[model samples]
Target: MQAVIIAALVIGIPLAIYCVCTVKREEIFEEGSGKNAEVLDDDGKITKETTMGRIIKMDKGMGEFLMANGLHCVTCTSSANESLADACIVHGLDADIMLSKIQKYLDENA
Candidate 1:
């Protein structure tokens, strides 16, 4: 029936797109999977060089940490290119303290 066909398409198309995006994200971001991959190191902590967008995408806990630290710019346009240190500087936060907290959180959760 026409209704069945429409329902199938409505559900199927987005599901297909979601699958594709998920695969691509894994391929691109998985440790050493691609050039400039956003990977956790042997210590399982993000480096100061890690970008805010990568943190938001790869680790929700770190993203939450950023949010709690007053870097609400996590979702802002400039976040894509901003490192943790850069964000801390922009927000007038202590990068060393934030990094230590983040590292401790990752260690405990790991």
Candidate 2:
């Protein structure tokens, strides 16, 4: 029994640590990738249904804006699947207001 417990701990701890490190490394790579470039094309529109990952990929500067507004999860892998409204709800922010602000940012910056 003791040997089983020891083996589990030895395997579990390293596996857990590796999983955490892999997630962080992926976040770093995604953030540094050319996908995060500032050059916006026709697809750069911000809408409530637009995924947070799509927004960030459209322009890295927008990611900074999102982080400032407490949506720091923009860099997370989950953001790829999370829309602006979904993220705002999860973050306890008013989705409409956040969307408006994001629109204004795009308008003024564009």
Let me know the TM-score candidate 2 reaches against the reference structure: 0.60
lDDT of 2 by residue, 13-63 (tens): 878866775576356445643343333346754678777766766544776
In terms of lDDT, model 1 sits at 0.65
Worst 10 residues of 2 by lDDT: 32-41
- Over 4 Å off, model 1: 1-37, 41-44
Please give the clash total of every predicted structure, in order.
0, 0
**Top TM-score hit:** 2
Query: lDDT of all predictions, in order shown?
Result: 0.65, 0.70
